[model samples]
Target: MNSYFVTATGTDIGKTFCTAGLLRANPTLSAIKPLLSGYEEEQAESSDSGQLLAAMGREATGANISAITPWRYKAPLSPDMAAAREGQSIDYAALLGFCRAELAKGPTLIEGAGGAAVPLTPTKLTVDWIADLGLPVLLVTGSYLGGISHCITTAEFLLRRHISIHAVLLNESPQAPVPEAQTQATLERYLPCRIFPVRRDAGAEDFRTLAL
Candidate 1:
């Protein structure tokens, strides 16, 4: 099974959006946001798990969402802090095991909770979890002001840790402060990997050729 971890420069910068696009382009690939914070049961239809379920051609039911994202917290904080608020803690070993098991099923795309540096557990960053899993990453960032620096810094950090980067996807944002071409060119100059620009209104065909 082909699997890749999808992370972003920052939260709400289109990680889920880009993942959904990829799922639409390649329906055979299964996607999951293993751990999600700020998850409201009443708003399941619009949550990250809900969106991913819809992209995979499944109904965003409560049971389905729970199956995909087992560790969910109501607080809209980082996973660690969110879990702490509920007097709980993430079992890193178990979480890693779950991810490994899921990847064994088939082509899977595991979406991280936030930026690559976000804390998964007290001692583990999101990138650290990806490194432990030994899966290549698809770094998703926005085409906004300072985006180039954010993308490069995150990529460099991963490269320093010997994490294989599958690609850098620059998802165009509405009212983007910087032009998409400029952001793409800057990233291309510094990174050794391919960089893809996903338009603000990208369609399935737009992502059809992506080698995720």
Candidate 2:
């Protein structure tokens, strides 16, 4: 099965939006959130992943939400810190099992929580987990000011690690300070990945226009 890991420069950069966009053309594709943090009991009732599933016109029942996301922290903090406060840790092998199970379902899109380098456990970073999954990644970067450095560093790290970066989505969030083209041009020179421009406040139809 063809699969791709969806990571971002930072949290709420539209990883779920871009992933759901892909599903518009390829309905067979399924999404997985391997280690979702900041999911309170109240938030889980209307989670980001659940919203993505809904936009894709899918019910939230089938996707790997619980098994993959073993640690759903109530506090809106980094995964590692949240798990530490709860006196628990993310089990890498169990997370891998969940990923493999999702891939077996069909073409899978695994969305990383926070950023690529987010810490899952005390020792394991999210990028290390993405490497373990062994799928090509599509990075989602918002077209906001100061995003150039974050996006380039992320892509460079992935390249240095020998991970295949399928594409980059430059998400333009609502009322965000826009980035200049020269900054994007700089990133093009340093990073080896395709960059896509996404407009702000895009609906499902607008998101579907994204080619990757």
Reference-based lDDT, each prediction: 0.92, 0.74
Give the alpha carbon lDDT tens digit for every residue of 1-212 in model 1: 37999999999999998899999999889998889999999999999999999999999897899888999999999999999999999999999999999999999999999999999787999989999999999999988887888999999999999999989999997888778998899899999999999998898899887875
Candidate 2 stretches greater than 4 Å from native:
60-70, 176-186, 203-212
Give TM-scores for every candidate, taking all chains together and pairing residue i with residue i.
0.98, 0.86
Q: Over the stretch 1-212, how does candidate 2's per-residue lDDT look in tens digits? A: 47899999889888877776776656767776766777765455367666556655766553334643445776677887877778887777888887888788778888888898988777788788888889898899876767888898898888888889987877775555645355556667877777766665555576555554
Q: Give the TM-score of candidate 1.
A: 0.98
lDDT of model 2, residue 35: 68
Best by TM-score: 1
Judge candidate 2 against the unseen true structure and give its global Cα lDDT, from 0 to 1. Answer: 0.74
Q: List the residue pairs that clash in candidate 2.
A: none
The pairs that clash in candidate 1 are none
